[model samples]
Target: MKLFKSNEWQRVKKSKAMVIALAVIALIPSLYAVIFLSSLWDTYGHVSNLPVAVVNQDQTATVNGKTENLGQNLTTSLVNGQDWKFTQVSEKTARSGLKSGKYYMTVTIPSDFTKSSGTLLGKSPKTPTIDIQQNGGRSFFAEKITDAAAEKLKNKVSQSLQKVYLENLLKGTKTSQDGFTKAAKGVSQLGTALGKVQTGAGQLQTGTMTLQTGATTLSNGLLQYTGAMGKLTNGSANLVTGNTQLAASLQKIGTGISQGQAANAANISKLNAGFDKVNQGLQQLSQMQVTIDQSQLNSSAASVSSGLSSVDQNVTAVLADPTVQEKMKTDPAFAQQVSDLKSNLTATEKSSQDLKTSSAALNTAVMQQISGLKTQLTTLSTQAITLNNSAKTAIQQLNDSLSQVANVLATQAAPGATNLAQGATTLTNGLGQLNGQSQTLNGGATALSTGTSQLVAAENQLTMALQATQNGSDQLAQSLANGAVKLSVVHTGTKNVQALTNPVKNKSTSLSTIANNGTGMAPYMMSVGLFVGMISFSTAFDFITLGKKPKSGMHWWAEKQTVMATVWSAQAVIMTGLLVLVDSMAPKHILMTFVVALVTAFAFNQFVTMVIVALGKMGSALLLVFMVLQLSASAGTYPIELSNSFFQVIHPFMPMTYSVDAFRQVISIGGLAINDLLVLLALGLVSMVLTWLMYHRKLQADTVLFPKTAEK
Candidate 1:
């Protein structure tokens, strides 16, 4: 208390210079508070004054058949808005303005801006960009302000585009919904058609079963027919053999007669014996049991025809023999006999040809029946077993019919044998004429004549049977071809049904947002105001003045702190008053704002006192340095997260760190100021304790920024 009322006080009270200096000292914090806080108070509000250049070169683009110029729209919006003082310029002008510091930042809208914007629905979508270039040489705050403006412009553009995109997307969605509805209806109709097709397929399946049954029946009938034909063929073959024997006998008679001029009289008895054999063979043929399978009719007839051909060939070869021809010319009776044998042989050959034609017809009929059965089987696909019993029954019926035919054929053979017997008698008479001729030749001639007559009878019978078989085969083939056509319809119907079923389908959301950059940075800048105000307080007042050493360090610290605290209190009051005058502080908590400022001043005063007392003039220099550090590190303007490591490390220990927070809490941002108050007060208490402990030596031996010289 005495120190407070001592020489320093008297000198301060008496000198106008000291009072003016103290007043000026007080003005420093007040001026800083007014200038910094008021400047930043409505920074966002006055951002329209911030210099920014807009270079819009965007050309119009066609989007969904609509012309749009996105970049031009953005520039126009920015120009009309009060957010920034947007200077519309060309690209070259914008660049020059940015470099010359005429504009803090330049936003260049590329020529493809609108084009790229329209590509939102393209296969390769491109994000439209607004290129922002900031002037590095500008004041950091100016640059930051311009950057925020740029960000705001960008967000505005994005929001506008997003709204348009959403509208277009909704329109497209509506169109797609309509298309999908129609497609769904079409698919439903297709499904209904498929259902009808499925019903047809079921009917076709039934028809296929019927076809399977018919195929089995036809197959069985073919089997039975083949058996009958085989029997018939065998019988015909036997008859042919008998006739051949008769023809050979006639030939033998002719040969024997021709050779009568020679001493081949033994041939006459052989020829007569051949005639007996021919008659016996004819009798054997009449009684022979003939059986044939209809399926083998063609092959059997072919065999018969082949045999006839061999007979004809043998006859020709024999006639062509020089010896036989010479004999024929020399013996007139032999020639007559040979001529009769040859005429009989010609008849036999004609019958054979007729038989071959009949056999061919029968063979074609059988093959057609087989083919028809195969077609029906193919149509049946999986239902062949259903017809097993019916096929067997049909086969039995066919077999019975064939048996009846065979019996008829057997009866018919008797007349053929009678004819053959008469032919044989005629042949025997011919052989009598050749009684002294060669027997082998007479036998050959007789056999050929007999074969011709029997062959004629067999051929006529075969022709009738083959005609019947051919009619049945033709009917079967027609039925099977119809069934195949029905199955083809069923197959096509199944394919159509498959195509109707759904084969392809498509599957389809709206993101979170942030406050504008200006709004987001408001709390930080408000906090920065408090820190700048505190730093100004230090610069305004001098704690370490040129003085004599104090006897007691505790009294020295107490007196200095009291004076500093008084000045700081006034400074805080003036600052808060200026804050109110500027209308910067939150009007709702005007009282709290003052209290916060006062508390902040007290804390800041203690900190400055401690630094000066502990470190003398060096302490003041360090405090100034700390003030600069706190500007960045106190997380006042920018986020603490963006601060460097060194500042971050010391942040918790600095009183301005809490002061800024406390000011912001009481001012613009509304939060619990208690924590900041607690931290500030705690830091103050720490500074006080540290000053008490550290100032003892420094107060007794303090140094000023300008030390006085000792008396020379």
Candidate 2:
């Protein structure tokens, strides 16, 4: 084993080509790790260097009286973003650049972008669209990166637009608040007016009730006056009849005087007796006339007329009342009642006037007739006494006096009584008409009273409703005022709007954080480097050439392992140091990172050595194939699950997969994975055992085939 190890170095030192090859081989893994990891160290970080065209075809628009240029704003934000190298250009230039691969992607703001954004406040709002055209043929990763950039741009534009929309909405809210404040004030005034109306309604109800009472009293008085007029009519008829009887008696007396003056000295006694009967009749007629004169019908009629006038005045006043007039306009039933009452009162007033005039005329005529009759009856009585005392002396004088009395009675008393009776009848007829209307009047008054009571009830209900309405109006006004005040308290500034637009902020807390893409990729790239380095070492060094014959296959395996371990250890140290010092990879545990690197390198070297030792020169090609397979199978670039089914199926079998996992645990924020180290150690041990077995089998085969070389 010692001889084989010494000869291996002697062969490498003797050949200048081998010495240079060994030196190059020692750096292969470091070079591969640095080159590959550096290329993608911060791939996304440098995405800003990729050219992206921004076409600003959008025009400005007005949103709630404010000019908005969302397209221009988006362009400015995109230019400032770290996602892509955004350049503002025309649509034609952007398209040209996109087609010619001058730009990796093109972002186009549509002409109606701002216009569509302004529609958010409208009933049928339209969603604004941004056109992102990517040249997928340029580079798959570049296309994907630009796609992500486009998504970020879309989100940024959405946020900015949401902020603008919120600002406009807040402005509209402020205007609405002001309008509500004014409306509340108006409602407050309306409530106040409703209160006044309620008070006026109460007053109207009171007046209506009072008018009803007066109407009832006037109706009752009219009925009483009508009865009084009927009695006066009867008395007037009696006066007419008495006047006729007296006129006939006076005529008979006048004829008796003319006949008795011619024939009676013997009939003087009988003439005296007849004169006594005439005197008794005259006295009864005088008393009847006095009674008629004392009736005072004119006064009662004037009183009734006055009452009617009062009722008319009261009704006029009620109709003139503004509240009643207004109610009359609205209530057809009440209006009709009032109109009927007014017409009836007007007719009743005319009847009362006519009755008053007739009563005065009848009273005067009866008084004149009574005075004449009393005078004529007293004269006749005195003449009858004188004729009785001196029958022959003054019978002709007495007869002449009686004739004068009869003539006065016939001419004045009878005609006056007849005229009074006629006047009384007319008055009674008028009163009867008035009395006939009295029931109607009483009914109307009662109806008016009922209607007034109903009106009062309705007014009470209306007042209650108005009061409730006023209260509701007050509450509404108060609520609106409060709402306006609350709205006023809301802020709608740029900062507030921005906060409202993006209400939730992402606060991520990474459990295992890697500094950069390079750091994250360190484990995979380093695993790949170690495997490639092992393959390169296997190709450069002579694995099958032995300087001396070995006693056992174990000795042969030990000799190769010692040489490869030295070289692989050197490669691991150099690669790990460069990853730290040159590449600035900050692993969580630097020592653990180095240990994982050494273990990974050793595992790869053992695997390569196993393949080379077992397959000879063909094993080098197979080692390359093995490395290629492991590269794909290892969860290096992406998770093994993200890879194809072949890779996922082979993932657990690949030694590099564990190596990468161990490296990642040490390189990032976690402790080194014990399972990964054990798996890697187990794979290396297995490869070493397999290689030993292969060497043992080959030695036995050589010994059987060429016993002399085996013995040497």
Candidate 3:
């Protein structure tokens, strides 16, 4: 064993080409790492440097009487941001840039952007949008970063618009509060007015009842007056007829009085003639007495004195006799004739004396009575004349008055009385109507009172509702004020958020293309290449030389492992230095990357050496097969979970699996996996043990590739 080790070392040290070939063979894995890991070290750090295009087509518009240019503001904000290389371009330019891969994404503001934003107060407002077009053909990550920037811009615009909306709402709340206050006051006044109306309606009902009674009394009085008028009309007609008859009778009485006065004058003249005749007779008789006393008494004094005395006595007696007075009264001519002169003369003297005596009485009684009669007749006549005249005048006046009265009774009074009767009938009907209407009026007044009461109740309810509304408005106003304050805070927060527009800052560590899964595939590819390289190396060279086998299996394994360790260490150190020179290793994990890569190479070499020792050239074929299986289970390009169940089960057993995991931590994420390193070293130790045991068994069994051709 000692001689074989010395021979192998001398052979490698003397052959220049062998040294150069081994050195070049060790650089193979480093080349892969340098190419792949350089760009993946800080791949996302350069995302902000990616270009984006913007097209602003939005115009300015008036929103609530204020001029606004939303698109312009959005454009300015995007241009000022450092998240992306944004530029204001025309629509054509933006489209072309996105298609040609000059820009990762294109953001477009439509012409109606401001117009749509202004419609926020309308019934059905539309959401304003910013169109983002990305070139999916370019780097997917680049497109994603630009899309994120566009989304950020949209959020900023939305926050600013919401601030305006809150301000307007606050103003509206103030106006509504004022209106509610006024409504409350108006409801109070309306309640008072309704109460007054209810009181008035009750009074009106009472007054209507009183009016109904008065109308009834008036109707009765009118009926009585109508009857009186009828009677008065009839009486006027009777008076007219009686006055006409009285006028006629008075005229006749006037004529009779005038005739009686003339008759009375004639009678008085005859009476005076009779009274003169009587006086003449009395004078003659008185003269005769004187003559007889002078002549007849002297001549027949002696013879007739006695006889004459006797004759005087007898004549006195006869004259005094009622029979002679009756005869003389009956025979007025008896005293005018003188046939019995002596006797008659004596008788006449006696009669004369009696006549004179009676005349005196008669004149005293009869003439006085006659004079009184005459005087009375004269007065009566005079009065009758005057009365007749007056009567005629009165009659004329009465006739005139009666004629006028008759005409009045016929024309005026009669018709007036009839009209009064008709009017009374109408008044009766009117009273009946008034009574019914009064009842209806009472019902109406009652209804009015009830309606007014309802109105007052409604007004009171309205007042209460208004008070509640006022309180609600006040609360709403206060809430709006609080919202405004909160909105201000939001506005300030959004403004500050603008500084962090690009939350994901992508940086590129190297100028190398790291496409999809390129970084992930790097560690797997490096592991496979190194493992295959070691396998090919083991086949090309002979490190274990067993000339005399009088050693323990452990001693044989130790000698082979010592040589393999020296070669694998030199290869791992060369590859690690090359990766550092190319800037492939993460700067923070520089030392860890070197250590993991060197360890990974050692582990891979140990496993490949064991497989070759166990089966010679056939073992190389088997190792190749195992390499294929480990590639699938290594979890390099894809996680082990994504592989088939068989691959997942064998993942931990695969030597390259732990190496890939450790390399990823050191190179990409700038970390060290101590557990994976231990696992890899343990796998190496197991492979060494298996290789030693298998080599010992092959030697003991005298196993050779060609048994019949050669024998020891």
Candidate 4:
């Protein structure tokens, strides 16, 4: 304290130059802090002063039948934004303004802007662009500010376009919903029709079974008729033989006139019995023909064929449905299902064709059998009648001939024998024709049986296919109903569309809120000013030159400490006070800010003093270099991580880095950085100790070199 009063205050009190120099040193920090902070007080807020040009050449376009001038709307929005000085100008003027530095950026809206925007809803859409040209050669910060404004303008235009697009999309969605509703109703009706078709398929399947049963019955009947014909054929052969023998016997009797009348009468009675048996067989055949109905069978087959055709048509309709086709494209499983259904329908169609062919053939064969049987019955009946009449005539002739046997034998007996032989030959021929027809009928019956069996198999397959088709239709109806419900449930209101347009929103909260550029930058500026103040003081004041011979190096250190502490404290007060008063910096912890500033000033003073005291002018030059490095490394404007690796590596070592952080914590809403304050204090104490050690070494060297000066 004695050293400070005697050595520092006496010099300042004695000379006006010394007092003015000390005053200038005290106020230097304030000048620097206030001047820099005030200049950057609100850089972004004053961006409206920066000139930018807007060239709107876009014409009108139609969107959804409504005329829109997107370019004009964007121009109006930019003019009203107040973020930038957006001047409406021609393209040539905008370009010249950019070249002449009259504008930092020029935004050009081409004539096709609105047209391209309108194309968003078209099949071939065009992208709308807003051309932004920036003049970076002008003030970099001004160019950067305008660049930001341009980006914001782009965003505003995009939002507007998006809002219109979303509105149109919602309208289109509503239209689609209406169309889907109608389609759903149509699909429901189709489902009902398909249900009826399914019913018909079942009935047709039953009819097929009935037809198959009838075919089996007809086949069995044909087999029985064929066996009967065989028996009849054998009997006809025997009758022919018997009749020939009877005719020969009659001839012999005619020749032998002594033959008895009883024998002739007996042979005539046997012929009468044979004719009655033949007539009975023909009656049985006629009765069998009456039981089988041809028309009914043909009608059932036609009905089944028609039902199969309807089913095929319905299947085709389902496959052709747009909803099903869309599903087929997206869903592999659904595609496979449709493919299987198509295969089943194809098989059902083939079966229907086969059944129709078989039915026609069966009908033809039955008709032939019935007609042939009828004709054969008619011929056989006529022949039987003639034969019966001949037998009775022969009986009457025999009775008449009982009186004249030789003449009766010579005339009527021989003629009766010849007539019997002719009747027998005709009967045999008819039986042979019947037998040949029976074989043909048997073949038809066999074919009909095979076809009916196949038809039954096909009917079962078709029934399964129909069942699958019914299931698919039901699913389709349900899907359409679901889709319609979903479409109805969607909300396409203005608020919802807006929400969709900007799906993500930013919600930010700051732990330490900086009011503006000035407030945020105040800490760095204050720290730099205080550092420069210390450097200035170090350059101006003589810290190493002793005013008097001291008892020890500690005494020299104490004197310089008092002078430095007093001056640094005054600089800290002035700088901090000016930040609050001039720059309007309202720190959260005002007292803490003052305390941090004072400590930072002291830390800087000690560091400067230590280096200057140890190395004199060269140390001052080194501190200047250090201050420059600290400016970049201190993370004042940007984070220390954003700096180069060298700066980042040395950032922790820089006293200003801690000082800036400490100032921010106290100035902003963040809590005080106790660790930073401690670090600053530690740096100051270490520098002070280092200065003391250097002073101690110098005193030792001086004492050795100059014993008389040291002793004084």
What's the TM-score of every candidate structure?
A: 0.47, 0.68, 0.49, 0.66
Q: What's the true lDDT of residue 300 in model 4?
A: 43
Error of 1 at 361 (Å): 35
Q: Report every candidate's CA lDDT.
A: 0.54, 0.66, 0.55, 0.69
Scored against the true structure, residue 61 in model 1 reaches a CA lDDT of 91
Mark the 10 consecutive residues where model 3 has the least summed lDDT: 288-297
Tens digits of per-residue lDDT for model 3, 448-486: 334334433443443444344334333333332332233
Candidate 2 residue 339 Cα shift, in angstroms, is 55
Candidate 4 local lDDT, residue 425: 71
lDDT of 1 by residue, 1-712 (tens): 6646754465356678767766666666656556655555555566678778889888999976899887877888878877778879988888888888888888889999989887765555687888999976678878767766667676677656655654554344334333323323332333343344335334433433433343333334334433433443453344446664644444343343344323323432343343344334333333332233443444434443444444445445445533346657877875775575466555544544554454456446434543443343333322222232333343344335334434433444444445555544543433333222223232333333343333334344444544543443333233323322322332223333333222123342102121233333333443444444444545544555524445555665665665566676777777667656664444335687677777777777677777665666676678667767767767766667787788789878666677667666655455558998888788778877877666565544554332343111
RMSD of each: 28.5, 22.2, 54.3, 11.1
Q: How many backbone clashes does candidate 2 have?
A: 0
Give the local distance difference test score of model 3: 0.55
**Clashes per prediction?**
48, 0, 8, 0
* Shift in Å, residue 469, candidate 4: 4.7
Model 2 stretches with alpha carbons more than 4 Å out: 1-5, 11-14, 67-69, 76-83, 233-490, 703-712
lDDT accuracy of residue 632 in candidate 2? 89
Worst ten-residue run, lDDT, model 2?
Answer: 289-298
